[model samples]
Target: VEVRPNPGGKGFVTALGGKWGWSGSGRAFVPQLVMYAGPADYHNKPKKIDADIETYLVGHGFNGFHTIVCCRWFDINEERSTRIKGPAPNPDPRTFEALELLIGKVHSAGGMVHIWAWGDESRRQTPVRLGGKNGLADLRLQRYIAARLGPIPGWTMGYGYDLDEWVARKDLDIWHRHMHAQLGWPHLLGGRSVGPNRYRRGAKFPQIYEGLDYSGYEQHQPTYEAYVAALAARPKRPSFSEDRFRVRKPSPYPKKDYTEELTRRGLWHSTMAGGVANIWGKYVRRGQKTTFQPYDHPEWIKTNALFFKGRFVKDMIRDNQITDGVCLRRPTGEHFVFYKEGAESIRMDLSKMPGSRRAVAVDALKPYREIDLGELRPENQTWKAPQKSDWAVAVGEFRK
Candidate 1:
C-alpha cells in the first residue's frame, strides 16, 4: 500500500488514508520486533509460524512487525563469504519464498512489516566487498529485491541495521535514486542510523534524506529525553525508534536490564514524544524456538491497548509545557496526558481551556486498573495517584 507522510508532517498515512497515526487499515501501526529463524523455519513449520504471528497480532495489540530480511541474522546464502567471481549474486529464491510467506501472513492478519534488508554485519553483501568497482553489482542486487518484494502491500524497507557505520553517502544517494525508480510501488524507504558513539562525527545523517519517506534512530538504551530529542530533530517525516534497550532473558548484560517497568516507560515516553512507531526488541537465543507470547508482559499489553485503541490518541501532540512532567495534549487543550516517573501527583495547567473535564489516574505498575478522580475543572489542577510509583494521568474525555 502507498504510505506517505501525514498532512501534519509528523506521522504517516497509507493509501486507505484517514488522518495521521493510523495505518492503511485505520489502526495505529505500533511495531514489535520479530526475529526470523531462517527460511527453514518457514518451510518446515508453516503452521506453527502462522500461529505465532497470529498471537502477536491478535493476542498482543501490535499491528506491525519489524523484521530483518538478509545477512548475518538470516542465513540466506553463502554468497557474501564466497565472493563469487561473476556478476552480482542473484537474489536467493529461498529467501524470497520465506519472505513471501511471512509477508502474506502479516498482511492477512492486518499488520504491517518493516523489512531490514541487512544487519550490522552486512558490509560484505554490499559493493564494499563484492568488487562492484562501478557499483553495478550492488545496484543489481537491490533491483532484484525491489522487483520481488516491491509489489507487496503493508510493508516498508530499510537499507540495514547500522547504516551510518559502513554505507557511503554516494552509495546511499545512488541507491535511493535507483530504488525509488525501480520499485513502482510506494513502499517507504530509509535506513537505520547507527547506534550512538560508533563514529566520532556522531550520526550526521540528515533528518530528511532526499528520497526517503521516513527517518529512523537506533539506540541500545535510549532515555525519555533522548526519544523526545530524536523526534524533535526529525520533524519533517515520520520517525521510528528501530531499536531500544531489548527485553531479553538470560541477562545479555551483567544486570537484569529488561524490566517490565523499563519497557512500559519506554513505550509511553516514545509515544508521548510524537514517535510514529517504535519496536520492542526481543533477543532470542540460537536454536531456541520462537514463542510469540503476549502475556509475558501484561503491562505492555495494557499500555498498547490504552494508547493505540484509546480515544484521544488520534489528536494528542507532545506538550511538555502543560505540566512539570512529560505530557501530551490536543491542540485545542480539551484533553491532556501527564506522565510522571515515581511521582504521586501531577499538576496540569488547564486554565486557558476553561471547562469541566474528567480525569483518570493510571498507575504505571497496574495500568489495567485506573483510579477515577471524578470531575475536574479547567483551572490549574493537581491529581494525586493512589501510590507514589510511576504514574500517568488522562484528563478530559478518556476511554474507561
Candidate 2:
C-alpha cells in the first residue's frame, strides 16, 4: 500500500470557483493518539494477525496511524500495581521482533508508528521489567532490536512526559542527549488521566487530582522559563485552542472559548480518552457491546472526527487564506495573511522561516481515506463554552 501525495491535491478549497475538494470542510485526516490494550505481550505474536483495523482506517481517509509499540511495558504509579507476566531484565525476543514487523507494516501503509513510554517509565532513568524484561534496560533492548530493524520509516516517538514535563526537560537541556533520546525518535508526549468528561464534578478520583498536581499550568512556567533561558529567547507561542477530551459520550465538559482558542492556536492535546482498552478491547473487537463511542458505533467517530477535522481545515484555510472568492495574500515572508473585505488569520510554517528550525512546526499530512472519528452531533449537554470557564485557562496554564 505505497501512497504518494496527490501532487497539488484536488485543492480542498480552491481559490478558483471549484467545489470544496473534500465533501464537508475539505481536509484529509485528523492526527491520532492510540493506546494499546487486550493481550499483554512481552512477545505478542499472532500468526494470523488481523490488520482489519489498519485496513478499516485506510477506508476512512486517515492520513496515518499511530501504533503503540513497546509500552504498557510497565505501569508504575502510586496505585497498586500488578507486574505483567514474562521475563524481566532480559528482552523478550518475540515481542521485540513483532514490533519490527508492526513498524514495517505501518510504514508500508504510509502510517506512522509511535513507540510510547508511559507512567514512571518517562520519569525513571532506570530500567525495569516489561513483560519479561525491565523497561529501563529494555529500552536499550528496543534500541538493539531497532538496530536490527533499521529505520523502517513512518514512525513517531512518544515519551511519557506531560506537556509541562517536556518544557521542564527541555529547560534542563539534556533531553536531546538522554538514553531515550538516543533512539532519535520523534516526540509525541502524553500522560493525562481523568478528563472532565470522566468526572461528574470536574474531577472524580483523588488520584486524578494528584496527577494534575504535577500537570498544572503554573508548574509549567518554570518549564517554559527554562525553555526561554536555554533556547536563548523567542516569541511567545502562537495562540491555538488546546483541549483534552473524555469518553462516555456527551462530553461531560466542553468549553467554548478555549475551543476557539485551540482553533485559533492551531494546536492541541487530544486523547483517544480511554486507558489501554480503547484500542485493544473495543476498536479491535467485532460485534461486542462497546463501552466507547467510536468503537461501538463507527458513525460516532466519523461525525465527531469531522467536527474536529473541520476546525483544522478552518484554521489552515484561515491562515493560508487560499481564497478565490475570499481573496488571499501573503503580506510578509511566513505570514499567510487572509483578506476579503477584512483580515482573518495568518498561516506560518515556522520551520520555513529563519531561526525557526528548532521551533514547533505546522504540517499537512497526505489523505488516507478512512474514518476513525464517529458521527458529529451537537456538543453533549455537559459541554460548556471554552472561555466561559477556567477549562481553557487551566489548560493554557497546564504546560505554561
Candidate 3:
C-alpha cells in the first residue's frame, strides 16, 4: 500500500512528536542505548528483565535509555495448534501478550523500546533473510504486525538491512516508508560496522528519503580516541551505535573486567562522539547466565547508578564540537580543551573564548573531585592535568 502524504503535504507524523527531534532533555540528540533480550525475558519470566532494568540501568543518573527488543525469527514466525506449521504470517498471540507486557514495563521505567526485525536477504557483508520468498506476502506480514503493534507508545522499529558496508538499495528505504506510514513511528536504516567504514557508508545515501529518521553503525569495541574522531567527522544527523560493547573470541568480557565504570565510560564515549551507544546485554556465557545481568557485576551497578551526573562534562563542552584536537567550542559559549590518556598537558589558545570563564579539570575515574583551574581569562592558557590519569579541562560559562 503506497502511503500518500497528509493533507498538508507533509509526510507521516507520529504521536511521539516530529519525525526527527531532540530528546526530552532538549540538548541530547535521540538519546538511547539498545539491548537484546531473549523470549523468556518477555514471556512468563518477565521478572528477570524487569529486575535487571529497575536495579541496574534506570533511575538515579541513567535516564532516557532505549533498548531494542530482539527475538528469534522462529518465535514470531511459528503457527497455532501448538505445532510447527508452515507460513504463520500473523504475530502469535502469546508473543504479542509478552511484547505488550514488556512495552508497558519499558514505559514505566522511563525508557523507549524498539522491535528489531531483519530485512529481506541480499548478498552483503552479513546476509539476513527475514522476509521470505514472496515479497507481497512479506509486506502483508509486516502490515499485519504493524497494525497490531503500532499503538504501543514510545517505541520504534528497525530492519537490519545493511551490514558493514553500503548496499545502495531502494527496497530498504521502501520498507522503512511502509512501516512508517503503517505504524506511525519513524524507522531507522543503515549499518556499517567497524570504524570509519561505518560512517563512510552512511554518508553516501541520497539526502532526502521521506520516512528515514535515523541511522546507526556498529562499532565492535573501538578505542575511545578512534570512536570520538570518526563520529565528529561523520554526517550531521541523528546517529545510533547498533553495537558498542567489547567482545572476545569465545565469550564477551566477564563482569569483573566489564565493570560499571567501563560501561558508563563506553556510553559517554559514544555519546560524546555524537552517536548513541547500544549497550549489548548479552555479555558472557556462564551456565544459564548467557545474557547481560547488570546486577551480577558489582561495578556495573555501582558506577551506572551514580557516576556521570546529568550532563557533567557535556554541559561544559559544546555539543557536536567535541574533537580530539586541543580546542572545542560552540557559538552558544561552551568551551572545552582536554588531553587524551597519557598526556601531561596541552598548550591551548583561549583567545577565541570570552573573558572570565570557569576552568576545571575532570578525572574520568573519580568524577567527584573535579579540580578547579580557577578563573581563566582569554589568553594562551597552559593548563596541566592535576592528579593525571586521563584528564580533561572545560572552560566555559558555568551552569548550575
Residue 393 miss distance in model 3 (angstroms): 3.3
lDDT for residue 367 in candidate 3, whole number 0-100: 29
Best by lDDT: 1
| TM-scores, each model vs. reference | 0.79, 0.40, 0.67
Report the C-alpha lDDT of model 1 over 98-176, residue by residue, as the tens digit: 7777777777675667777655545464445554422656666667767877777667777776666676666567777
Q: Model 2 over residues 53-160: C-alpha lDDT tens digits?
A: 343344332333333333332331111123444445444455446566665554455444445433334443223333322234554555654454433444433333
Query: The CA-based lDDT of model 3 is what?
Result: 0.46
lDDT of 3 by residue, 1-400 (tens): 8855334221221222211232333333223443545444467667865775665445323433333322233354332123323444334466666666776666566555555554323432111233342254457656765776675554555555333243333655666666667875543444333334333333432322323555455444544554555444444444545553534225443531334445645654654444443544435567755454343343332333243333333223333323333343445554554444545665666666667677776655552356778888877656665555655566664333
Candidate 1: deviation at residue 393, Å? 2.4
Worst 10 residues of 3 by lDDT: 10-19
